[model samples]
Target: EAGVAQSPRYKIIEKRQSVAFWCNPISGHATLYWYQQILGQGPKLLIQFQNNGVVDDSQLPKDRFSAERLKGVDSTLKIQPAKLEDSAVYLCASSSTGQWNNSPLHFGNGTRLTVT
Candidate 1:
């Protein structure tokens, strides 16, 4: 089976600019997620999706970040007016079951973004 795929493995932009990241989750997975990892910190869940509908986004910075899963397969995450503090690795992950289940998450290598 194919793993989650991400593009533009790395990106660099000045503060106040905008950037976008792309992800393609494994097939047949019903749950997908986005996580942000700042250097020296653990990855933090930013949003979760179940079959093209948003399931959780409590940790997402709504004013600066947005994400969408289209038709339950491909997903995109965008940041507007990037902040130096936003420099981090953005990871995409997927599981076969919903949040309540114990299905292990499979993650993409991630897109590393650096805001200068």
Candidate 2:
């Protein structure tokens, strides 16, 4: 029984540069999510995917941020023309079911992004 996995635990780039992060959810998990956590602030849901279809992305910044859960197993998140405000920790989480309220989401350690 393994947990969620994320790569490039830390990243640093100049403002306006592009960055991408990867996530591999637990096996059999049907729900995946990406979140952003600014220092001193709780994580904010950026996107939610059930299998390969998007369930929610209302908070995602469409102008610069994009994410996808391909094949309903792995996911990737990218930020283009990254802004200084985008400096934060990006979290990847997943649940075995779509019952968000009833199922618990397991999270990876997260990728810390720094924009200089």
Candidate 3:
């Protein structure tokens, strides 16, 4: 089965420090997304991209968070001056166009970031 891949399965960082996470989506999937999932809350879409171009990023904090999908394949998200509240599981997901509503999305375990 196809799935997304993330690095640094777990990380602990000090507040005000910087960190980065990486993701590789399933091959051939054109839509990629980054989500932040905090305890007790559902995953929230942080950014979405279509073939290297950003489709939506309104919810992302431009002041501290940034992401990019190079060549529309592998992507990376960075957080600078991390805050305690920034601790959460960062998820990466992908799907073929028009696939949503037709099938359920498969999401793998993502990077867990903890700020102390």
lDDT-wise, the better of 1 and 3 is: 1
**lDDT for each residue of candidate 1 in 12-108, tens digit (9 for 90 to 100):** 9999999999999999999999999999999999999999999999999999999998788899999998999999999999999987899999999
* Per-residue alpha-carbon lDDT of candidate 2 for residues 1-111, written as tens digits (9 for 90 to 100): 899999889999999999999999999999999999999999999999999999999999999999998799999999999999999999999998884567988999999
| Per-residue alpha-carbon lDDT of candidate 3 for residues 22-73, written as tens digits (9 for 90 to 100) | 9888888888889999999999999988889999999999999999998988
- The lDDT values for all models are 0.95, 0.95, 0.88
RMSD in order of candidates: 0.7, 0.9, 1.7
Candidate 3 ranges with C-alpha deviation above 4 Å: 98-103
Each candidate structure's count of clashing pairs: 0, 0, 0
- Model with the higher TM-score, candidate 2 or 3: 2
